[model samples]
Target: MLERQSTVGSAPIGSFVALGDSFTEGLGDEAPDGALLGWADRLADLLARRSPVPFRYANLAVRGRLIDEILEEQVPQVAELTPDLVSFCAGGNDILRLGSSVDRIAERFEEAVVELSSHAKTVLVFTGFDPRGTPVLRRLRGKIATYTAHIHAIADRHGCLVVDLWSMKALQHPRAWSDDRLHLSSEGHRQVALRAAGVLGLRPTRSAPATHALQGRVRQPQRLDDLRWAKEHFLPWLGQHLLGRASDEVLEPKRPQLLPL
Candidate 1:
């Protein structure tokens, strides 16, 4: 967790803008303020409680958003906000749409970051959890990992923060998923919120129950013996230790092209 000390009266006061897709929109069996209870609202609530001044939140998340769409419309909106803090959650749709090279995703993300950094002091970017273990939507883990790495490298180059959400408890076990399997359940969302709170230096508030009953019935438990070992071991370790911190190695020479893989 990042250490944040309140400097008497120095907490910057400004609006917070969240730009992303369904995760940001909180699409599931939950609702807050007549809308899906997404992470951005959760983050904003946490920040308001922790900071010295109250800040407003602006959510610009639309469901089914791809990287190209984000770059086209959302990026410019975020750039215009000039917010004190900005949270970006993208790339899942990219993996879904174009399972191409990592370099390609990196280029798109880098452009988004360049525009974001020019306006905000701190930007929080999310790398999604491993999706290979899912029963229905399995087999895309490699592509997702490639896209995640691209985003990570871009965040590294720009000195932004990342939340390695891909490494949490859900990927290994069958119980972590909601009925839909793609989106997180209310509890799943809460767990994610807790981890995100740890990253953002804020506290999480319990989400309200959905106005409508949650769809998708949970499936019977199946053993995860067929899943890859790296899904169980390496990804979680990276998320806990490396994702949000600066590189530890001392360098005689500094070059972005030679960055660690």
Candidate 2:
């Protein structure tokens, strides 16, 4: 088991900045207002409520961002913000791609973590979950495992807190995932936010219910369900990769500037 940092519970966070791709961008956790409410946002809300002072937050995560893209584009900006806390979850998009090198990705990922840790009082990193539950993403399970191991090592070396998504049994359920089979569902995001808060030793304003109870009985995907998913999400994603495009190429950051929640 990874040890929690002593500093995690030592102080209240005054500011927070999140960095990463679709998972961090809150894809499946859509708000009633049509905004994405990923785990990072939820965590920020929790921190805001617990904080004795005003809390400022910014989320620079854009979907489909690669590790290098986050390092080059978001890291400098995040460092400038100099927030008290930073949550970074990237490189899953790179590992899911064909012919990607886990070692090379890890090197870049570690570099970014080191840089971010230097700027922020606390840096949070996440391990990629096992994709074996998703039909299409199942093939990348081995790669995801390898990448997740690297993440653990990197986070340890930098003294950063790690949220081990790989071992979250509740996330293995199909219902915890979105129709895309890549991102987490709204409930999944909520559970993650709760887990993150626990790591940081912060009590949320509202209680988070058990993830397994919310999911109920696990149902296997039918043939029609798989076909529908492939037609609706997988094929378009494949075409985008083939053409060297990304879903977030034209999308903007949900919260570009830091503001009080």
Q: TM-scores for all candidates?
A: 0.71, 0.91
Best by TM-score: 2
Global Cα RMSD, each model: 13.8, 3.6
Would you list the C-alpha lDDT of every candidate in the order shown? 0.62, 0.83
Evaluate model 1: give its lDDT. 0.62
lDDT tens readout by residue for model 1, 95-174: 65433555676688888888999987778788867776564345777777777777778888998778887776443444
Largest lDDT belongs to which candidate?
2
Model 2 per-residue lDDT at 84: 90
lDDT of 2 by residue, 5-38 (tens): 2235667688999999888999999999998898
